[model samples]
Target chain A: MGLLAYGDTGWGDELFFATLMTIAVALVAIFIGFFLAAIFASFKLSSIRILNLFGSFYTTVFRGVPELLVIYLFFFGSSGAVMYVAKIFGYDGYIEVNAFFTGALSIGIISGAYSTEVFRGAVQSINKGQFEASKVLGLKKKVYYYKIIIPQMLRLALPNISNVWQITLKDTSLISVTGLVEIMRQSYIAAGSTRDPLFFYSFAAVLYLFLTFLSMKLFNNLEKHYSRGY
Target chain B: MELMIESFPRLLNATILTIELTLLSLFFGIFVGAFFAVLRTSKIKIFQVISYYYSYIFRGTPLLVQIFIIYFGLGQVEWLRESFLWVVFKEPYSCAIIAFTLNTGAYTSEIFRSAFETIQKGLIEAADGLGLNKLHIFFKIKLPLAIKQSLPAYGNEMILMLKGTSLASTVTLLDLTGVAKHIISTTFKPVEVFIVAGSIYLLMTFIIHNFIKILEKKLDYSK
Candidate 1:
C-alpha cells in the first residue's frame, strides 16, 4: 500500500519522469537509426560490388554481436575516442563524452542493422522499370531519388520500421548501465533503496508496457495511412 | 600487472562459467523458442495469439531489465526468499541463466516463425503428391528446409545471446565482462581492461560468424 501511494514515500513522480526519459532516449535512437540505415541501405543497393559488400559486412558484424558488448565498448572506450578527436582539433583538454550519447549510439547502431535489412527489402521491392523510366524521362538521379524512390520505400518499409521503433523504445531501458537517469535506473535505485522490489518493478514494467502500447498505436496508424489504397 | 596475472586463473574459471551459462541457456532458449514457433504457426488461433503476445512482451524489453526483474525483483520478496523456488533464485548465476534463456527464446521464436512461414507451399504440395504423410513430410522435407532457412537468423541470435551473457555481471556473476569490471575498479583503468574484454568478445563473435557462414554455405540454400 505504501509502495503504491502518490506520496514522497512512493515512486509516483520518479516513475513518471523516468518513463519520459525512456521515450526521449527511444526517439533519439530511432531517428539516428533511420538516418544510418537509410544510408547503409542505399549503399547496399548500389551497383558497385565493393559498396554492396561493405554494407553487407557492416550489418553482419553489428547484428551478429550482442548489443551489451557494443554498449560496453563504447562506454569504456569513448573517453579515449573523444580525446583523440579533441587533439586533432587542438582542444586537448579532458573533454568527456556524455553517457547518454554512448547509450543512444549503441542502441542506434544495433537497431540500424535491423532497419538496414528492412530498408533493403523495401528498396528492392520498388519496380526496376520505375527507376529506368525516371531516367528516360530526363529526371536527374537526385531529383528522381527524392521524388520517387524514397516515398515508395517509406510506404513499403512502414510496417517493418514500426517494428524496429518498438524495439528501440524498449532497448532504452538498457541506459541504466550508462548512469542515465532513465526509467530503469530510477526504478532500480528506488527499488534498492526502498526494498520494495515487486512494487517498483511492477511500476517499471507498466511504464514499459505503456510506452510500447502507445508506440504500437502510433505505428498502427502510420501503417494504416500508408496502406489506405491497398 | 602482477595482480592481473594472479587473477588469470580466477578469470579463466569465470570465463568457463560464462561460456557454460551462455551455451546452456542457449540450449534451453532454443527449445523454448522452437515450442513457441510451433505454437505460433499452428492452426490454433488461441495458441498463436498467446505466443504472439508473450513474445511481444519479452522481445520488446531489454534482457538487462528482465534479469533485474528476476534476480533483484523476485529475490527482494519475503515469500519468494522463503519459498522452495528460492533455491534457484538465490543464485545469481541461475537467475541470470533463466532470464537470458527466456529473453533469447522470445527473439529466436520470431526468427523461426519467419523461417517456418517462408517454407514454400509448392514444396509441401510436392511432398504430399509423392505420397508423403504429414509426419513424413514434416520430418523429411519441411523441417530440414525450415531449419536451413533459419540458420542465418539463428546464427545472429546465437551471437546476440552470447553478448548478452556479459550483462550477468551486474547481478554478481563474474563472467568475462564482470572480470573486466572488477579489474577496472581495482586498477582504475577502464580503458585497458575493457579493451581486453571487448577484444575477447569481438574475437568470439567473429569466430561464431565464420562458423555460421560455413554452415549456411553447407546448407546451400539459394532461396
Candidate 2:
C-alpha cells in the first residue's frame, strides 16, 4: 500500500533498514555467543571442579532468568556500573548505554549459554580415538584442533547452531524495549504514528517469517555442505 | 543486599503474578496443544492442514510479534471491540494470557505430537485387540504414555513458558520484570532492583528444575 511506500512520507525504507539492523544485531550476537560458548564449553569439559562449577553456574543463571531481565540489566543496570568506573577514572558524566550494544550483548550472553551446552555435547560426541590418532600422526595441538577436531565439531554442532541462530534472530525483537530501531520497534513506531496497528504489525510479521524462512534454507544448505563426507 | 531484602515483598508480589500468568496460560495451552496434536495426526486432511499452518505461523514468528498482533492489531478492529470477545481482549492481562496460551500451545502441540508418535504402535494395537473403543484407548493408554514419555521435554517447555511470561510486562502487565522495572524507575537503582528480581526468577526456575528431576526419577522407577 501507499503507506508502505519509500521515502519520507512512507515507511518502506525505514522498515527495510530496520530489517537489516535486526540481521546485523543478530549476526553480532551470534559471533559473540560462539566465542563465549567456546570458553564455557572448555570450562565444562575441564577436569577441574571449580572450572566445571563456574561453567555450570554461568549457564544456569543465564538460561534460567528471563531474557527481558537480562536485557534490562545490561541496558539500565550497566549504566550504574559504567558510571562508577568512569568516576574512578575521573571522567564522570552522564554516560548512556547505547541500544545496539546493550541489545546485542544481552542476547549474546543468553545465546552463549545454549551454545555452551550445544558445543559441549558436540565435543563429548566426538571419538576419543580421533585425538589419539592425531597425536600418533605427530600433529601439534593447534593442528589437532583445526584439522582433526574443529571440522567434526562443526558438522555435529551445525544443527544446534542453527537453532541458536533462530533463537537469536527472534530475540532481537525484545531489544526494541531499549529503543533500538529494529523491525519490531520500527513497526511499533509506524503503527503509532500512522494509527494503523493492524497493517503495520501484519507487515512486520510477514517480514519476520521471511527472515526465518531464508535462515532455515541457509542453515539447511550449510548442514548439507558440512556433512558432505558423512 | 540490604536493598534486596527491603524490596523483597514487591518482587515477591510480582513473582506471584508471573506464576499465575504462567500456570493459567500453560493450563490452557496443554488442552489446546493436545487437541491440535490429535488433529495434526488425524486422518482428516483439513484438520491436519489447519494444525500444520497453526504451528507454522505461531512457531515461525517471535512471541513479541504475536503479542503485538493480538494486542495492538486485534484491538484495533471495530467489530472485535463491539463483540463479546471484547471482554477478554479489552484488558492487558487477558490479552497476555491469550497470546501466551496460543504461542505455548503451538510449541506444546509439537511436543505432544512427537510424544504421541513415540507411543509404540503395538500398544495401540493391543488396546484395539482388547476391544477398547478409540476414545477409551486414547484416554487410557496413548494419552498417559505420551505424557509420561514427554515429561522431560515438557519440563523444558515449562521453563521456557515461565520465562516467556515476562513478555507480558511489555504489554503493561505488572509481572516480575514489570515490577522490577517499576522499582528501578522509582528508586533509580537498576542494579539492586534487577538483581533482586533476577534472583527470584532464578530461584523459581531452580525449584521447577529440581521438581522435574524428581518427577522424572519417580516416573522412571515406576516404569
Candidate 3:
C-alpha cells in the first residue's frame, strides 16, 4: 500500500498517469481504426475488383501478423522514414518518431483490420428490402446512406465495436515495448526498482481489469441505448 | 533483399519453435478449457463462480502482462522458489507455455461453455430416456454436439493462439518473431525480416483455415 503512495516514495502517481495515457492512446487508436474500417469496409462492399482485392489484402495481412511485430515495424520503420524525409529538407539531425504516435498508429492498423470485418458484417446484414425501399422513395444516394444505412449499421456494429474496443485497450499494453510509459511499462519500472515483481505486476493486472470492467459496463449501456425502438 | 534471403532459413527454423509453442499450449489449453467449461455449466454454485472469475481475470488482462507475472512475478515468491515447483517457473520456456495455456484456456472455456449451453435439450433428454448414465450422456452426446458447433470459433482461436505465441519472444524464447527481432537488431533491417516472418505466419494461417474448413465439412453429418 505504501509502495503505491502518490509521490517520490511511491509509484502510484506514475501508474495512474500511465493508466490515463493508456486510455488516451486507445481512444485515438480506436478512432483511427474506425476511420480505416469505414474505408476498407466500403472497399469490400464496392463492386470494383481492385478495390475489393485491396481490402481483402489489407485485412488478411494485418490480421495474420502479430501485433508485437506490427509495433516493432512501426517503431523502427517510422523513425527511418521520418529521418530520410527530414534529411531531404536539409535537416540532418536525428528525427525521433515518438512512441505514442508509433504505438497508436500500429494498434490502429491492427484494429482496423478487425473493425473492417465487423463493419462489413453489419453492412451485409442490412436487408436488401431497405435498399429497395430507399430507391423507391427517390432519396439521393448521400441522403439514403446517411439516413438509412449508417445509423442501422452503427446499431448492428455496436456489440462488435465494443469487442474491438476491449482488444484495442489490451493491445495498448504491447506499446510499452515502444518505450511508452503506459501502465505496463510503468509497472515494469516499478517492479524492477522495488524488487517486488509480484506486487507491481499484480497491481498492473488489477488496473487493467478495472479498465475492462468499466468499459464493459459502459458498452452494455451503449448497446441498450442503441437498441431502443429496434 | 539480401538480408531477407539470408535470414529466411533461420526464421523458418525458428518457426518450428513457434509451432511447437502454439500447439503444445493449445493441446493443454483444450483440457483446461473443457474442465472449466463443464464447471461453468455445472449446477454447483461454487463451481460456476470459480469458473467465471478464472475466465474473467485471464481474459481481462493482456497476455504480455500474464507472461510477465508468471515468468517474473512467480519467481519472486520465496516459498515457491524454495519448493520443487521452481523447476518449472525458473525456465522461461515453461513459464511462457504455462502463461499461454492459462490465457488460451480461459478464452477456450468461454467458447466451449457457450457451445455447451446451446446444445439442444432434446438430445440430452433422448440420451437420458435411452437409459444412459449421466456420464455417458455427457461424453457421447453433449460433448460431440458442442465440439461440432464450436469448430468454427475454435478455429479462429487456433489462429489467435498462433499469433499469441509470438509473445513468447518477450520471455526470452527464440521463436520465429524472436529470431526475426534478433536479425533486425544485428542487420538493422526490420522491414525485410518482418515481411518474411509475417509471410510465414500468414501461410500458417492459410493452412489452418483450410484444415479447419476440411474438418468442418467432414464432420457435417447433413452433408
DockQ of each: 0.42, 0.79, 0.83
Distance from true position, residue B3, model 3, in Å? 0.7
TM-score, chain B, predicted structure 2: 0.94
Q: What would the per-residue lDDT of candidate 3 be over residues B1-223, giving only the tens digit for each residue?
A: 8888889999999999999999999999999999999899889999999999999999999999999999999999999999999999999999999999999999999999999889888888888899999989978888888889999999999999999999999988999988888887787678998899999999999999999999999889787
lDDT (tens digit, per residue) of candidate 1 on B89-186: 98898999999999899998998899888988999999899998999998988889888989988887888788789888889888887877676667
Candidate 3's C-alpha runs over 4 A off are none
Give the TM-scores of the predictions, in the order they appear: 0.83, 0.97, 0.98
- Alpha carbon deviation, residue B131, candidate 1 (Å): 6.9
Candidate 3: give the TM-score of chain A: 0.96
Worst 10 residues of 2 chain A by lDDT: A72-81
**Native contacts recovered, each model:** 0.44, 0.79, 0.71
lDDT of 3: 0.94
lDDT of 3 at A140: 91
Docking class of 1: acceptable
Best by DockQ: 3
Which of the two candidates, 1 or 3, achieves a greater DockQ against the reference? 3
Instruction: List model 3 lDDT by residue over A21-84, tens digit each.
Output: 9999999999999999999999999999999999999999999999988888888888888888
The order by descending lDDT is 3, 2, 1
| CA lDDT, every model vs. true structure | 0.81, 0.92, 0.94
